[model samples]
Target: MSYSIVVDHVSFGWPDGTTVLDGLDAAFPAGRTGLIGVNGSGKSTLLKIIARELVPGSGSVSVSGEVGYLPQNVPLGAGRTVSDLLEISATRAALHAIEGGDAAEEHFAAVGDDWDVEERARAELDRLGLDHVGLDRTVGTLSGGESIMVALAAQLLKRPEVLLLDEPTNNLDLDARERLHAAVGAWQGVLVVVSHDRALLELVDQIAELRDGAVRMYGGNLARYEEQVAGEQEAAARLVRTAEGEVRRQARELVETRIKIDRNARTGRKAAENNRVPKIIAGARKRQAQVTAGRQRALAVEKLEEARERLNEAEQAVRDDAEIRIQLPGTEVPAGRTVLTLPLARAAGDDEQVAGVGGKVLETLVVRGPERIALLGPNGSGKTTLLKRIVRQGAQVPVRYLPQRLDLLDDRLSVLDNVRAVAPSASVNDVRARLARFLFRGDRANQAAGTLSGGERFRATLAALLSAEPPPQLLLLDEPTNNLDLASVRQLSQALSAYRGALIVVSHDLPFLETIGITRRLRQDRDGGLAES
Candidate 1:
């Protein structure tokens, strides 16, 4: 099959000597591919290498044609305009100069037959639902979602033969996410994206999984890839069971052989002492028997070791994603309890100042019981602000909020210390035990919170939140799945499953919301009204 991108025996490491990819090789055909792995698996680093934003320590990367890359975190430089981001400012300037009758050779040279750069840029922006964003507007003036869409639009306008995107759907609202997914689905060139956005991944032609320092390709989209992995895991599990039985049998036989040899030795010794045969002959027989027993024991021990080795190999075949297994505070807000009450309309009073939910009959936002609510809204719709207001005024129960930026943890503190800070009543051992459930075991728990990878930080932040002293009876999460890898998303969902509190999570990840068992869906409309969908 023809390939548009080829990575050959690539290896890379950070300046701190932390190894990322090692002798990695991968090839992408002229179709979209979903690149997925746990956080810290080098997904972003690999994309950077392919984009030539970072040089690999060894090997090389070759692309079929011009490459366009949209990094996960778009650098929103202050005072940089959208035209600058699109890289069409010069052409636009030249076009305007020519329109003004400045017959400069440099202007003509800069135009380079791209006189319609402005129109094309606008069209691309409109395609990505960025029509609301002006080309001359500074990036800093745009919302996070708007900036992402603009960055994506910049890459799309290049129309390069190869495109690389890292977490392109991050911070996007539902509308923006749909638009991005549509754009990705229509991509014709070699497109590869590193993202936990399941909807975007579902549009890919293949799934490339990065794990254990290697890349493995599967011949289908996210759902199909999951099916294939599930089948493989099932078969691997069967092999493990079979290998375990063989190891047990080998161990039992080894024990029996040793017992029999000991019995024989005792019998021979007793015979020699009783002088059943000449002592010299008995001694020779005993010596010969001892040699035979030694040889037998060695053979048995070898077989047992071989069986154990096979068992280990079989177990290795099973993928253990380091799933987080944690129990949230068992504090359940009663079903009839009024966890939070907010007048969403602008009319009520001081407490309801942060009001307005689209057109739904939600004149007042009243959250009761341990209801898991999915907060859906467009960019600039005030979802995050609403979450903050809830913390400030609404929630009657003990509450905690995890912001979208995940800046809750104290960077200087160790993970254990961070958790301890929130749950001071709990013993250090208790916090350590809880952190272990989040996969921060032993020394990992002692690492400074600032040193954690995206996934680790999320887990650590979550551990601290749930381990709060009084235990949150109402939890608010803003874009909780942002920057998380697929497995990390799963781990987050697992952690939330044990949370016995009312939750209001703002996110565009529909599949994630479904996994967390959201009981209700609330959308904040651009008109500042809250509606229940």
Candidate 2:
């Protein structure tokens, strides 16, 4: 079969001797490939290597055709416009037109020999759902989601033979993510996508899991991979149990034999005081001792060998089960009557009039103590906007909002400084202790928030929000599960379950929501009206 890209014995390591990928070999074909793994499992690093942004320390990567890449966070050049970025291609084409460059034939085929390139560019922008985004608009002025879409559109215009995308759905809402996924699904070229979204995985032709510095391709969807993992884990557990039982049995037998040898030796020594008969007995006792010793040695060797084998097997069984660690501290404050009430809350339209309004009037939505409520809805359904409004209206109640985007944090500040700034009165020792609770201990706390990985930054933000003096009687989280590894998500869920306050979370992860005990459902309509479901 023909391959678009091939990696032969590729190996990479950081300057600090941390091996990210080791002797990995894989081939990407002309179809969607979903790359799934833990947070730090080298998915992004491998993508970077394929994009030529980072060179591997060893091995070789061969590509059959041109490559287009969309990085995790698209860095828009300072003051650059959409037209400025896209016009470069047009300029190159015009130059090619004058000099009869190699690509001139392809350009003429795509557009007529005298076709208006500006019209084609505008049409491309519209096709990518950026019709309203003027070519003159500064890239900096665009939202995170908008910028990502535009970057993708730019790559699509290139019509490369292969495309590499790293967490393209990171900051996108439901609508935008769906649109992007559709565009990718329709592409007729080699596509490699690294993402954690299960919905996105369904669009891929094959799923490749990156774990333990190697890529293993599974011939199925995410659901099938999950089923396989579950079966493997069960098998591993059974093997471990059987091995443990065998070890225990061997230990008991060894102990019994040792005791029997000691007793026989004591009896033989007492009888040695007799005559010739006693000497014969002594000889027999010595022989028995040697036999017992041999048995014991054999048993010991067998036990050791069995244990080593079992350990190796167990390690392999659970190699992919690493979890993230996130601890959200709880406040000591007791919940009050009606933790939050939005009576006839509404947002005005562009004309300064109530575009659409609705009311949820109850005597009290009492969260007596430690009540966890999850807000569920589709994309652009106002889940986040509702949380923000609640925090604003309930100002008297100490509340902390952890936005999906951590942009509110100052990237220049150290993790410690960021936490300290949140609670200025907190002493350095106290701040350090709090940061440690969130897994940012020792020198990690001193690292800049910008330098921390996505998971680390998320934990730091949570630690800062939960470390206040009054300890926020209410916690407002917007898609807190995004970018977090499975382990960290579990840790946060456990902590929130134990919290003695109110929790209002916005998330699309149904399993996580169920784990946290979200009992209420809220739905928003196209007319901007909110209704309890």
Q: What's the lDDT for all of these models?
A: 0.88, 0.73
Per-residue lDDT for 426-497 in model 2, tens only? 899989887776777799899998877766777777777777656787888888877775556766776676
How far out, in Å, is residue 167 in model 1?
A: 0.2
Candidate RMSDs in order: 3.0, 6.4
lDDT of 1 by residue, 1-533 (tens): 98888999999999999999999999888899999988898989999999989999999999899999999778879689999988899989889989999999999999997878888999999988887888899988888888888888888888998999998888888889999999998888889999888889889999999999889999989999999999999999999999999999999999999999999999878877887788778878978998999999999999999999999999999998788887664657878799888976553333332334433347789889999999888888789988998888847889899988889899999999899888888987888898899888999999999899888899999888888878899999999898888888898899888888899999999999999999998887665667776
Choose the strongest candidate by lDDT. 1
Question: Highest TM-score: which candidate?
Answer: 1
